[model samples]
Target: MRCHIFTRDDWGKTLDVQETECGSPEEALQLGSAGVANQPTEVWCGPRRLGRFEPERSHGRPLPRLHALLTLAERRLHEREQHISKQETLINRLKREGRDLALALCVLDTLIETQKTHLHERDLIVAEVAKRFG
Candidate 1:
């Protein structure tokens, strides 16, 4: 059987893709596991996924620190999203009352930028989790 191994970096970016011949799916899985020294890897046969391997440090153990950080990031991202929603609602209400929107719009813009930062932080954490716990 022909197998393809995909090696990914800590950020889930594909660093390399290699093709190898294996006798079976087990051989493909072994090949993938052997090559996963410090990165995450995936083995595939045609359109079927054979197996996935992670670094030894995270082979079967969960990193409490990383999990906590991911939870915090997700919570912060959700809070920011809620804040943006409320800001938009407030802006709409003020507009309906024929009040000045210049300051409100500026605040909304700042909130949006902050939300983007939160989203980026959450994405980074998610990628890290994927790399460690694939």
Candidate 2:
């Protein structure tokens, strides 16, 4: 978003403003600090004025608008984190299922080999009995 830091005249008319392109309101606040002197500096997004900063006041508490913007950013970050966590969990589950399927195939292969060996033994016994009877 594009933000502007403006110094307003006593009549509440804008005297001068510095335009800065920022991703978030926090960045705008940081950029606005440099333009602020003894005059009150206000941050604007597009045509809408968001918040004002006073040099006399400590920066500990943010203005209501800035606070709401920061809160929204935080909520979006948390949602993305949760989505990533769920994706990781699903990937882990898929890996475990793949391993189990591989193991089952291995067991089936072993059983087939065992059945082939038994058939070979039975053939030998039948051949011997046929020769003796003939």
Candidate 3:
């Protein structure tokens, strides 16, 4: 099979194109993966795209593992957001009831700090993924 490998820059613009002949789609994928050592690459056979590979970061972790981590980070971030929302609601209710709010407010402050950490973690993972795969 004749395959074309497209090397893309950080902004996703095509920087170079190379054509090679391979025995199978797997071979084309391997070639593309190797190409990703220098830059992001896309493998195509005629009009069909066989695969895409990004420069490996995360200490040489595989692409699927990075994707899995991204998924987990996003889920955790979402859960943290919900917890923060519920905490805010509870604090508001305590205020309306004329209940002592020192402890509740303290807990809310802690939750806000934790939410900030989660946001930072999620943003880091997102930026890493975009940098590697874009």
Off-target runs (Cα >4 Å) in candidate 3 are 1-59
lDDT of 2: 0.62
Worst 10 residues of 3 by lDDT: 57-66
Task: Write the number of the candidate with greater TM-score, choosing between 1 and 2.
Answer: 1
Per-residue lDDT tens digits for candidate 1, residues 39-126, read 7899999999988898886353357656765777788778888888999999999999999999999999999998888788778777
- Candidate with top lDDT is 1
Off by over 4 Å in 2: 57-134
Q: Give the best candidate by TM-score.
A: 3
lDDT of 3 by residue, 1-134 (tens): 89999998544678899999999999998888887775689999999999888886557555776677677677877888888889889989999999999998888888889878777876877777787777
Estimate every model's Cα lDDT from 0 to 1. Answer: 0.84, 0.62, 0.82
* Candidates arranged by lDDT, highest first: 1, 3, 2
Alpha-carbon deviation at 7 in model 1, angstroms = 35
Ranking by TM-score: 3, 1, 2
Per-candidate TM-scores read 0.52, 0.38, 0.53
Candidate 3: count of backbone clashes, pairs at least 3 residues apart or interchain: 0
In candidate 1, stretches whose alpha carbon ends up further than 4 angstroms from where it belongs are 1-62
